[model samples]
Structures are given as structure tokens and as C-alpha cells.
Target chain A: MDMDMSKNMERVMKDKQEGLEEWSTIIKPKTSVWNLYIKEIWAYRDLLILFVKRDIITVYKQTVLGPIWFFVQPILTTLVYIFVFGGIAGISTGGIPKPLFYLSGIILWNYFADCFTLTSDTFIKNQNIFGKVYFPRLILPLSIVVSGLIKLAIQFTLFIAFYVYYYFQSGIAPNYSAILILPYLLLLMAGLGLGFGLIFSSLTTKYRDLKFLIVFGVQLFMYATPIIYPMSSIGVTAKEILFYNPLTHIIEAFKYGFIGEGEFNGLGLVYSGVVTFIVLTSGILLFNRTEKSFMDTV
Target chain B: MSKVVLKIENLSKRYRLGEVGSGTISHDLNRFWAKLRGKEDPLSQVGQVNDRTAESISDYVWALKDINFELREGEILGVIGKNGAGKSTLLKLISKITSPTTGSIKAKGRIASLLEVGTGMHPEMTARENIYLNGAILGMTKSEIKKKFDEIIEFAGVGLYVDTPVKRFSSGMRVRLGFAVAAFLEPEILIVDEVLAVGDIEFQKKAIGKMKDVSSNSGRTVLFVSHNMSSIKTLCDSGLVMSNGTVSFKGDIDSSIQYYLGNSKNLNSFKSYENLDEKPGSKDVDLLEYKLIDKEGEVIDSFNLYEEVSVQMKFHIKKLNGKIYPNIHVLDKYENYFLVDTIPENEIPKETGIFISTFKFPKYIFNTGEYSIGLAVTSFPGSIVHFFENPAIIFNVTEDDLSLRIGPSTGMLPGVTRMQLQTKTLKI
Candidate 1:
């Protein structure tokens, strides 16, 4: 009877051991550079969506005009740009209406700037939450990108209203290429913003000086991208220097597609696309490496 | 015979001490250059053990070193240690909030950690919305939160203020709501830090009960870190003690507590009396030595609940005209006096010399807990305190089987002392 009881106990223990061995997760100090774990990110999609919603809703929760600030912000910036660049400086808008010309560039620039700034500050701003819980660290920056897109969609509608108003006033139809290249332009903008933001976020954890540089650097980059002045007005030497900037082609392409009035270079756009891809890939690699140890340093 | 659900192997974490940004870029570049040249990184060899009191000779220090343990299924493990003992570092590593420097952890199921209460709560968001946000941050799905929504509100007792902004809620209400959500997480493995100390006593009790239910009834594992010994003993099955970034002991909860309390200030029962300049005492008497001793006449800092123990005190007198008697004040862990033992004036000394006094405590006097002893030497007739020392020695008391039968299954009785009361039955 004793031997039989011992055998039964052994079998029960084996079953319990087998039950626990069915599912396990192993945590290690470093993961391979190639293992992006896209499936894990996909599993956490709901969390990503909730974060996006929180960012958008909480930004204007207490303001008197609430979300109307989304439209009012771009409208006010565009008015200032038209006065300062178009009316005061007599800058040519390639024959497009001044408001229409300036609002398009301002709206798109605001989206990129907002996305870049918010995403770049992810590691510093969310250190408390990150230090306490385990979730995909990428979710914070990805949600910032998504929330910035939502704001852009709202501001883009305002741009479209002016686009229609100018189309009748000038009787100039938008180029057919605008329909085909709009998605690509937006993708390029997002890729560049996300890429640069990731790189900056990872670097700033170690050295905080970059955090101060980014605010002024974005404004300086805008002048180089032909936001206020047309590309046709610049000399050959200045144009060549501006062509080296990946954003230069994207903005030029956006203006050509929507108003049918700027220079179009297929090779330059291809170069911009290639550069964006490289920057984004390297950015992700740096970000993954930093997320493992940023808490210790930050 | 339970299955091992979590295994940590040779875990270690090294950190750089002092300024975070001083020449770190040059260090990084130097390490990179050395790596490219196929040479050693130079800085990895100089790390010392994590001792904050010592002057740092190198920039690197090991926050944790060679930690290895296996936790079985449904086992509630209590981690107890002093500040800077790397308890939080261990939790952060297990939760994957930070990575270890040299080892790996294999866990069987989903792990959720409440390292801090209301970690990601946004003040601008309403209480209900903050619940969803905090829950999502803790790895719960939106649908999972929805399923437990009403229960969370009911448990938090904030149904009327659900729509109010979290900033407007009282701190107590916020803690209640935060703990309510975390308690309902239902993960396979739960890790809790010192978050339970935030709420009121009633909520703390409820939280401990819910933790017990989660581990026992649902067959989940739990890792709890706390400085509160009573709650740790009540909620945990086993315990791990950390000292100087290493696991000093791992065993059943009772002995672990004893070992932790005893070895906290070095393995010694005696504390040297020094620095009389700040002490409140008359120059007529000076305390020399104070310690607790077992029945074997050997120095001890811990005892069983029913064990006979003694307090040995040694003092010197510069001049004595009247009899000097010794009085011992026994205080509980919270410093509440429960007993005072004093000798008669005739039993004391009247001559000027060094003296020794031993006081005996019978069995069944002290219940299961920690007690600190204070000593006072006073004159006779007028009974003025010549010299007094508070908390001369501290000791721990463990529960005995005989005492176990006299109380609830929770292992403690209602009152402080366990007396031998007489009872009789009358024919009626």
C-alpha cells in the first residue's frame, strides 16, 4: 500500500510539472538586432490605440474652444506666414493664392513638427511609467505618430476648403500627379519624422544637449526646405545645397502635385525615399538598443 | 512537489556610480574603439559590490550579483531587505522594466507588477478614463477592462465620482481606485512593491485578502516586497532575504523573518554604549553593557514564543548613597509599552562599584512578534532615574505549536500577551 501511494504521488507531480511547462517566456539582457518582434507589437495593438486616444483627447480637455484649437492653430499660423512671407516680402507663390499656398506648407509642416517633437521626447517624458510596468516601449512613439496624423487630418480639411476656393478663383486645375503622389508624400513625411525622432530620443537619453538643439533646429530646417520661397527663385548653387536635404524634394513635390506650379524631379524624389528608408531602419535599430537600458541611464 | 514556475539563473546588474553624464560619451567611444580593435573594454573589470557607505574606487558597482532562485507554482514569495539592498532592482528585472547585466529569467505565464500605485494616471482624465488608461499600461486589454469595469467601480466605492477628473479626487480615493484596478488584473503572476502602504488600514486589509485569494484560490504566483513584517508574514508562504545585493537566505517565512531581523546589524547581540555627550543621563550612573540571553546563558537576539529568556545588563556607579534598582521596560514593535519589570530596593546595591543584573522572563509571556527592551537605573525612596537607555536590545518571538491551538488559524491572538487562564465547567 505504501509503494502504491508513492507511485500515485509521483504521477500527480509529473502532471503538474507538465502543466506548467506548456507556456513560458524567457527574458534576457539583450536581444538580436534583427528580432523586431513585430508579432508582440501586434498583440499590443489595443494598448497602442488607447494611448493614441488618450493623447488626442487630453490635449484640449480644459480649453474653452476644445478641439476647435486644432483648426484655429493652423489658420492663425498661416495668416502670420502670408503676411510675413507673401505680402511683406513680395515672395512669389507660383501664382497660387497667398493663403492657399502658405496654409498647405504650414499645415503639413505643423504635422511633421508636432509628431517629431512629441515622439522624440517619449523616453524622457514617460520614464516613470516605463520604469514601473512592462509594455512595448515603441507604443508611446507610435501613438504619438498616430495622434499627430489625426490632428493633421483635421487641419488638412481646412486646407482643402481653401484649395477649392482658390481653384475657382484662379481657374487652375490641380495636376493629375497630385492624386497619385499624395500618399507617398505623406508617407515620406511620416517616415522622416519618425526616423529622426527615434534617433534623437535614443541619443538624448545619454546626452541631454540634443533636447535643446531640436527646438531651434526644426525652424532652421524649414527655411532650407523652401516653405516660404519658391524653388524657381533660388540660384543654381543654392538649389544644389537645398537638394541635399531629403525634405526639399518632398515639399517641392507636394507643391507641384497640388497647385501644378513647382519643379518636379523624379530622381530627387527617389533619392529622398531611399534616404528616408535608411534613416528609419537605423533609427529603429538604435531605439531598440536604447530601450533595454535607457531606464538605467535616464 | 509543485512545479517550478519561475527560474532565475546567475542574475547580475552593474551600474555606474556618481555623475551620469561626466565623460560618459568618451567612455562609450573608448569602448567602441576597443571593440573595433579586438581588445577588452577595460571598464568591465573594476566593478565592486554595491556598498554605498564606502568611498567608490571605480565608477562601476554591481547592484545585484549572482542571484539564483526557483519559485514554484502558487508560491507567494516575500522579499525582505533594507534600503539599497537591490530589492527594487530585482523586481524591475523580473518585470522587464530593466534588463539584467548578465543573466536570464524564465517565467511560465503573464506577469503583472504594481511597482507604484497609479503609475500612469493622467490628472486631466476622468477617474473612469484613467482606469482604462492605467489598465492598458499594465498590459490588460480594453475588453478585459470592460468586463471588470463595474466591479472596479464598486470595489473602489467611487461610482458617484467616476466621471470626475482624477485630479479632483482625494488622494485616498485615487489610491482606492488604482488598487481596485490592479487587484482585478488576474494575471498569472503578480508582483507588488510597497504600494499597499498608501491606502488606509481597511483598504490594506482588503488588498492583502485579495492578494491571498489570487494566489491560493486561483493558483497564481505572487512576489511581494515590503518593509512591514506583519503583513509579509501574513501574506507570504516563503521568503527571500537580500543583504548587500545578494540572497542571504531563502526558506519558509518564519525562519527567514528571524534571520532577517537578527542579522540586520551584523551577527552580534551587543551594541556598544558610546557618545554620552548627547545622552540624557546623570553622571552618577553609566550604562556599560546590555543584551538578551537564552536559557543556555548564551547571547541571543531571537526566541520562540514560549521560551524562557533573560536580559543581562551591566552598569557602573561613580558614587552611591542610596540603593540603585534596575527597571526594564518591554515595548512592542510599535514602541508601545506593555510590561515593566523592576526589582525591590533591598535587592539592589548601595556601594559605589560596577554591577551586573539579570532579569528572567517566564515562558508564555511574549506572543509572536518583535519586542525591544529599555533599561532605567533609579535611586530608592524617591525613585529618581539616574541613567536610562531606551531600546537597549531588540529581539523577535516566533509562534509555538501550543500557542497555535489557542487562537484563530491566522496564528495570532487578539491581545498582546498569552496568559495561562483557568477555566472550569459547572453542572447545569
Candidate 2:
């Protein structure tokens, strides 16, 4: 063992000297922002699936309701909103039944809200592992969004059940026009949530003051979004103000697609979709830059 | 020549060392001023002497200064340093977890780091789910993870609990599962920092073995940071010794080890002797200071396979009641609790004030490592009236032929006892 180590040690010493000289002369530290974000993240798709699965399982684990909590949370929250906003406050639902009315907005909104809240603080929460490892940072928020989708799926099943029951009771159903736009609406909601969430995640890495802002801001944002009352219920001036909130078109379109009673304008939907695209693109760019050096700030 | 896979050049990192939020406003103002001056940064003052006590001294200090190195494919690089050294900071920079304040790094292949096992394992997620999640965070494809899924679970040894949520798993189990996923990951460049510090002894060994296999078998480059010199000698082919935020030595593991052990050994005795004063000594006398130095009058940081070092001692005799003999004892650095003591009874004296003694190792046949020296004054029979235990006059031994032969993965032999032996083979 001694003889072998000595020989190896000599070779290593020679190599180290040569390596240092070579490194000093030829190496240039440059980061490929685009390649790193898209390619590296694409490779780690398996981990994302695991993260998504972990999110879904852990949320329900040890609870008596298990996976049923996914269904129950949206159902219960929607029922409360119906009592408070629909029955007591006399908020209009654009002629859709209150349970169906609130459940559609609540389920879709829940997915976006959860994605935003989880992804907004990605670096702060994952600082322990992030400091120690080298992997694509975007994978953290990407996995959160993916995992949120799984929960959204579970809740959507309950929404379908409620829709079917209401359909039989009223002898009315979602028109073909509404059914065709369901996938698009889902994508829009995810894109917006992911974009905004990543923007905050990047900012929170440095300031940390943004964390409180995000938590409180999201709560107030819930009111601005057409989740509780349909867009049609608001007067003309108030409707114009709500139209400026990009989430308004998203939720309004989702309700209109499901219940066939809420307002949906092409110009508004296009404007919101464009906003989602820009937000997501900028978010990705910021997240890419932030992930590289959040260790120093966070 | 082997392929060079990773290169770092002129890398320097500046860190604000005190009061996290206090520097924010100053940093922003500096940034604004720099922009006004059309310069990159306003605070680029170099060689401004570090008056650590003064308020005018900038909070910023270079965490790393002109660090440069390269690694061949399949080579395991051991980064060794004391606390506040730039070892972890180097890893962070290479991993892109943080950017360098100045300089650049170029790596040829995909890198995966076990910076910490289970970085983002959601407590609510099952082990099975967490494995996937952690894998993704590590940049492994689903198919890649699936292929290794069974192997990972088996390696973690968690068995049927793979499907259970990770929060339910014990800390050890969580670590095991996390390590299993990370170790199974096959990236082109693998970086690990003191991760083997976790789990039981057996698991640590297993983790080290896995790291070795990853680097050796797959031709992957590995960068490992650790304070355990023995482990560095056992696991790394090359070494980078960092001191005070600079690459003090870089080369063959032996030379780097020699440089590190040498620089640190001299300081040990001073600290130990200073600390020894805190322990109340005999009423009559006190052992104030102790140290070890070499033939050239240099403090012996370490030794060769067969070398000599001198243990020098000094003390003050407040008032001597009777005759007392001085004794010198030696211990391995890792095991300073016990010692081998030799008394100079014949040289005893009834003292009044200052005293000094020197013990020599004419042929200090110790392995290349760290050893501690202790000093004491004893009465005629056996009772030690005053002593400074492990008063750290330390040294390391280096033998080029011997270290290379031991190879990587040998357990870190912690002391000098490995030195006091000889081996021979006789044919029957």
C-alpha cells in the first residue's frame, strides 16, 4: 500500500502543477443562461414527477380523509363562499347554481393560488439543499406547479360530480363551446400562476420583505379575481376596473366555460393570455439568473 | 494525459462578514456610486490593511482570492481546510449555487452535487415520492431515476417503507434514503461536501465507497471537501489545501497534506498552552508553555516516515517546596486523552522561578500524520503535581513512497501509533 501510494502521489503532484497552469490560461467562466434553464430542467423531469407525487401524498398523509381532503377542501370552501357571498350578501352567480358557481372558481383558483404560494418562496425554503447541491433551481418551482396540478386533478373530479348532479336537477348542461375551451382555460391558469410565482421567488431571494407582501397580496388578490361573484354581477364602471385585473378574464372564462352563464369577452381573454405569456417568460429569465446566486443573498 | 473536466481560474469571492441586514443600505449606495463613476463596483479598494477592530474597515473580505485548479476526468479532488477556509465556498461557486465575486469556472460535463442529501424532500411526501422529487432536483430524468429506483431503495435499506411519507421516517432513515438517491445518480461530475458526516459509521463507509465507485467506474470527476485529513488521504488522488481564504497548497495529496499539517501544527501548541492556564495547576508551580520544533529551528508542523522533532517546554515556579522532575508525554492528535510519558527525574531541582526542558525524537518513525505533545512536572514517586496535557506541539510525517502505496479508501488512521511498528514477511 505504501509503495503504490508514493507512486500515485508523484503522478498527482505533476498533474496538479500542469493542471493549474492550464486552468489559469485557458478557462473563461461563462454561464449559458438559456441552455442551463431549459436543457438541465428538461433532464430532471423524473425528479419533478417525484416532487409532484410527494406533494400530493404528503398533503393527505396521516389524515383520516387522506386524498379525500383534496376534494373536501374546495368543496367546503366553496360552500362557505356560497353562504356568505351568494345567500347573505346577495352576490349574483350569473344564474348558475351557488355550489356549482363557487366550486368552479374555487377549484381553478385553488390550483393557481397554491402554485403561486409554494413557488414564491422556493429559494428561502430550499436554501439548505440548494447551498449544498448543484442542480437546476427552476426544478423546485416547476415541481411545485406540477404537484399542484395533481391536487387540482383530484378536486376537478369532485367538481365534475357536482356538475353532473346539478345538470340532472336543472336539465341543463355546459354547451359545446364551453367544453372546447376547458383545456385552454386550465393552461392559462397554470401559466399565470407559475409566471407570477417564479417572479416572487426570484425577488424573495434578496429582499425577503417580498415574502410578507406575497402572502398578504395573494389574499387581497382573491377578491379582485372573479372567484366569488361573476363578472356580470358588477356594474359597468366596476366591471371595467376588474377587467384590468388579468386574473378576471381567466376566472370569468373558466366559469363561463363550465356553467355557460358568466361573461367571457374575446378581447379580455386575449389580453389576459398575452399577460400570462409575458409574465411566464420574464419569470423564467429572472428565475434563471436568481438560481445561480441565490446562495449569496438567501 | 487524462482529460481535464473542470477548471477554475482567478476565482475570488467577497463576503460581508457582519450583521446581515446592516450592510444593505451601504451596499446599495456603493452600487449607485459605482454606476455614477462608470465603474463595475465602488468598493474595489485592494491591500487596504485589515484592521478588524476599526469601524472604517469595510465589512467585505475576500472569501477566496485567486483560487485556481483543474481536475482530470475520473479524478477525486480532496479539498482540505479549517473552518473559515474557502473550501465550501469553492464548492458553492463551482456548483453555481453562488457566483464568484471575480473569475470564472469551466466544466465539461453535467454536474450533480450532494451538497446535502434530501435538499427539498417535502416532509409530507413519501420516500418513493421524495426519491423522484429529489432526483428531479438533481437533474435526473424520470427514466434514469426509474432504472435506478430499485437499486436506490435497496441501497437505502429502507425496504417496504419506500412508499411511506418521508416525515414518518427517522432522521437516519431519511438521510439514508436521500443519500441513496443522490449516490445512485450518475452525473458526469459529482460533488460532495462532508455528507459522509451523517448516518452511522457503517453507512458513512458505504457512502464513501459509493462515491469512490462513481468516480472510478464511470470516469466521473469528484470534488470532496473535508476537515478529516485521513479521509482526504484515503479518498482523494489530488488535494487542494485552503487557508485563510486562499489556495495555500495544491498538488499530490502528500505534498498538500504536508503543507497543511506543517502550517497548522505550530499554532496548536500555543493555543493548547494558552488554554492549559485555565485549568488550575499545583499550588507550588505552574506549567506555563510547551511546544515542538525541528532541527532547522522551524516549528514541526509534521514529520516524514522516519524523522526527528524536539518537544520544548517552559514554566514558572512560584515557590518550590521540594524536588520535582519534569516529564514529557506524546499523544496522537486525534486521541489527546492519553499519552506516553518519560520523566527526567535525575535532572530534578528545587526551583524558584523559570524552568525549561527539551525532549528529542532522534528517529521519529511515525507515519505522515499529526501527533500531540504534553508536559508535566512530577514529584519523586509518581504523583504529577503540575502538567499541561495535550499542550499541542504537533507534527506530521510524510513519505512519498508510503502514501501512494496506501491508495484511496483506506480508513483515516488518526494517530502516530501506526508509526511505532515495523512489518516483515518470512518465507516458510
Candidate 3:
């Protein structure tokens, strides 16, 4: 109750209108939500670099074959999918070489899956540091997206090698559209992963049982994502259902854009982009609010 | 007086306690039902939580309530409290690690808190890298961190190891390096919590000295929370003593320490049992409770320092009262044990229903410190049957002529009773 404090309090009270502020209060929540989406995360760019470096360093520490695991994980996963789906199940790789087809899907799908899984556990994984300090909480989930992108880049290099080999040996030309739309595809994957991850991260803080469900849920979600088989192989009714799968449009558009024989309607890609934007925006809002009071609950 | 740098008003934090058991969910539902209908919390109102056990099923308690205080620029304020007294919660609130459920806090400049040693330091990172990383996390700019990088290294006293991974450093070395970086970051407001409790005495001294320099040289406000009374007395200009989450006493360091010590000494009743578990150095025989009374058998608070104050003890000897004698000692506020007096065995009566002894303080010889009485009934000189050291009963010595000296001095001057000392004066 000093004069200076009274003056400061008056300023704060003036900034906060009483009756009319309620009508505009809806705007407050929305802005808090949108502010989290990209603006606050962009400010924590240095933290993103540090987290990316941390993720890379921590993974290879104490292992003899360092950074090689980055290449080995996607290669082994693609081989397993190709053997099971193409060889045993008699699935078609859409007339494209099986390795390139499987490698491409694995590369794109892993980025989304990795981002989703890591983002989902943002609150739980860093509970120790989060409890003791306050920074932009979005820095954590955004960093996960960035680090997963780095990993995707390394795996994508392997896919590039496969693409070159397939071009020379089997004479399949990668459509020029693939090069133009590559960055947008990356954004679509990041948006979807971040959206799903943040939703789960917020829910898991209060209901810890969701954390267990998320692990198995992400596994089941991968099978449903059409990574092993193209949407063209499903029956007509199932194909219609697959269109409702928002990620299907993005992945299908990517395949058609790159391999030229896959599905690539511009409107379908736009629908996928719109859905990604909505999820990313909503996820940021939920995440921003959750970070403010999570210390009390978590 | 300096300018105010940080202000906190009407802060409160509530915590739900003891709802972690098999049937807690059902109990919590019942309590919530009671609360919704304008009734008090069911468990808390009824005191249903068993007092005998350490755990309870109470619904909620305010860990901190209505805490208000301000800090001036360059002032070092120490927060002292017992366990469960919400000292850490206050620090966490000011650092903005957590927001208050109510109230507003405003700061004048960037605030950095060293709530834990080497917080956010990745073990895989080298010492040099961790300095930059932790510094940036504490709100220091990259250029600011780089500018002090050499000074931090020098203060940590770990040259050539700057390139070594932090995991390779010893725990003490890691703490030193972490603290060194925080000190050099040159924040406008520094918040530290019991991080100095780790490391050896040498490092503790170094950390304390560095904190002193940081507060004095840079004129940065510091909020320090510690359980160590001596450390608080040495470092803080003002102290805040918290009890049950409210500011109970705020003023000079001595007054706050006095308030804290006074709480521990419950002077409600003149009679109590000297339980060995409650007090140290107590053996078999039970010396129930003792009261400081006058010749009229009336309990009193102050003594003339020249008049004899009698402590009457009620006890029972299971075996023999053959060589029982009472030993008393006077301790100051800092717990520097001063005088020890022993009663002769020959003066005790054979029937031991009650025993009393009176010792006179000649003339207020002690300095300005909270003085507490300690009583011990010993069998012979070596073994103690019941002993209470530093009991809650506290008093202070007041004087008109106590000159504050700058440095360490040796010798006893003109006083009624001279405490034995040797003085030396040499010209440099």
C-alpha cells in the first residue's frame, strides 16, 4: 500500500475492464491459443537448436555405432514392411520398386509418428525441469518437431539414394511436382504430429492412464495410416472411408505428387492442409494454457 | 534506504493433503459433496485424520496464505522457517516458476533464480557449453554470458577441465561451476534456495563470500532461503520468518531469528516431561518439567541478572538417586553454549518427589542474544539421566552501552563479571 504500488495497481486495473472485458474475453482465450501456435515458439528458436543438438547427442552417447542407428532404423523398418506386405501378403507397391515405395512412406510416416509420440509426452518427459523453471513451454513440443525433422532429413537421404538407384535400374522418373511440394509435405506432417501430441500431453497431465493408452494408440494409428498399403488397393467403400482420414489425403497427395501414378488432386491436398492448420492451431492453444498451471497438477 | 525492486501482495497457495490411499477416491467424493452444499470440508471439520499416524486424509490446507513483502534494491533478504513452513513455495512464486492462485507480483528487472544447483545442465555437455546453456536459461544474454565466461572459470577454480564433460566432474566441482556461472550472470534480482548446503566447508565459504560480493558490489536484490541460522545471521540485512505460510515476523535479522526460536520454545506450561526423543543427552531417569520461579514460587519472564532464578524439577528415580545432581547450561541465540553449572550430590534429599536449585546471573553480563535455559539431571558427573538442551523458553539481554566493533577482538573489558580472556595490542 505505498503510493507507487497504488499507482501501479491503478494502471493494471485500468488495463483490465470489468463488465465490457467479459464480451472481449473470448478474444483473450483465442489470442492466448493462437499466440502459442507459432509466435511464442518462434521466440524460443535458440532453445529449439539446443534441444535438437541434445536429442542427437543423447541418442548416440555410449553407443559404439553412433549416428548409424539413424540410417539403420528406417532401413530395417522399410525392409520389414516390404517383406510382410509385398512378399507375403501379395500387396502391390503401385508398380513402383518395392524398396522406394516402402522407404518413401516410412520416411514421411516416421517423421509424423516420431513428432506425435514425443509431443504427446512433453509434460511427462520434462517434469523435473518443468517444475522448477518457467520459459515458453511450447519450446519443448516445438523442439520435438524440429529434432524429428533432423532425423527425417538423415532418413530422407537414404530414400534419395534408393530413388536414384530405382531411377537408373528400373527407369522410373520422379515427377517434377515432388521437388516443388516437398516443404509443404513436411509442414503437413509436423502439423498433424504436433496437434495430436499436444492434445495427449494436456490430457495425460491430469489422467496419467492416458499415457499408457497413448503408447499403444500411436502404434495402432500407424497401421491405420496407409503406410504399408496404398489407398488405391482398398475397396471403393473403404477408399471413401480413407478420404475421411485427414492424413490419408496428405500422404496420398505426396505419393501421387512424387511417383506420378498415385492419387494427387489439388483439392484433396488443400483439404489436408486446412485440417493440418486447424489441428496445429488448436493444439497450440491447449498446450499454452496447460503449461501455465500444469505445475500444480503434474 | 534503496528503491523497491520487487513487490508481492496477498499471495495464497492451497494444497490438498493425504488423499493417496485405496479408499481415498470415495472419501474425496464425499468431501466434495459436503463442500458443494455450503458445508465445511468433511474430513477437516471432524478432525477424522488420526493424529497418531504420520499420514492423514485431510482434504485441503492453505500452505501459504496472504503473504506480503517487498525488497529494496541491493538488499539481501533471508527467509527462514521450519520444515513445511512454505519457504520454498514463496521462492518458487517470486521466481515465477509457478503462479499464485491469487495475488499479483511485479518486478523491476530481469529475475534469475538458482533454486537448484546446475539446473537444466545437460550431463553430456562440456563445462564450457553448460555455462552458456544454463546462463541463457537463467535469462542472461549470450553476449553477457560470454563476457563473464573467463571470470566464471576463474571463480570455479577448474581450469583445463572446462573442456571436460560435466558428467566427468565430481559432484562438488559441478556445484561450484554451476554456482559460479549463476553468480557471474549479473542478474538484477537473484533468488537462491538452500543450494549452498552441498559441497565441503571450503566451497561453502567460497559460495557465501561470492554471494556477499554479489549483493554488495553489484547492488542486486537477493532473496535467500535457508534453514541454517548462522548463515542467515551472517548474510542477510533483513529477515522474514514464516509460520504456517504467513509472514509472522519481519524486521532486522536478530528479531526474526528471535521470533523463529521463540516459536520452537513453547512456554505455555511450566511442567513437562523431558522425553529423550524430544531432547538430546537424556538417559533413563525422567525429569518431568522444570519452572523458572522466584523465592515466592511464582513463574516469571525476566530476571534482574543479579537475583537468583530457581528451577524446580519433579522426577522419580526407578533404581537409585544415589549420586544425582542437576547440571545447567546457558546458550545464546547462535547456540554458542556458554556457561555450565553442576549442583553437588550431597545437597539432594533422599526422597526425590521434587528437587530445586537456583543460580543467579550476577549482572546481565551476556551480550544482546536470545538466551535460553537448559537443564540436565545427571547421575554423578559422567552419566546424564535427563537433559534438555536449547529449550523453547527464550529471553534477550538489553543494555544502553553496547558498542559495535568492526573486526574480531580479543579480551575482556570492564564489566561486573569478567569472562576469562587474554588481550593483545600490537602496532603494525
**Winner by DockQ:** 1
Which candidate number has the best TM-score?
A: 1
lDDT of 1 by residue, A184-273 (tens): 988888889999999999999999999999999999888888888878988999999998998888888888888887778788899999
Per-model TM-score of chain A alone? 0.93, 0.88, 0.86
In candidate 2, residue B347 scores what lDDT? 63
Error of model 2, residue A71, in angstroms? 1.6
The whole-model C-alpha lDDT of candidate 3 against the native structure comes to 0.73
Q: Which interface RMSD does candidate 2 score?
A: 4.6
Candidates 1 onward: DockQ, in order: 0.52, 0.31, 0.20
Ranking by TM-score: 1, 2, 3
Model 3 C-alpha lDDT per residue in residues B269-385, reported as the tens digit of each score:
154433212423334455655566655766555544434456555555544545777677777666767777876556764654545566555444555435676777778556645
TM-scores for all candidates: the values are 0.78, 0.72, 0.72
Poorly placed runs, candidate 1 (over 4 Å): A1-23, B34-40, B270-428
Residue pairs in candidate 1 whose N, alpha carbon or C atoms collide under 3 angstroms: none
Q: For model 1, what is the error of residue B118's alpha carbon versus the real structure, in angstroms, after optimal superposition? A: 1.5
Give me the runs in candidate 2 sitting further than 4 Å from their true place. Answer: A1-36, B20-26, B29-33, B47-56, B122-130, B149-174, B266-428
lDDT of 2: 0.75
Query: How far in Å is the alpha carbon of A283 misplaced in model 1?
Result: 0.8
The stretch of ten residues in a row with the least summed lDDT in candidate 1 chain A is A15-24
Candidate 1 versus the native: TM-score?
0.78
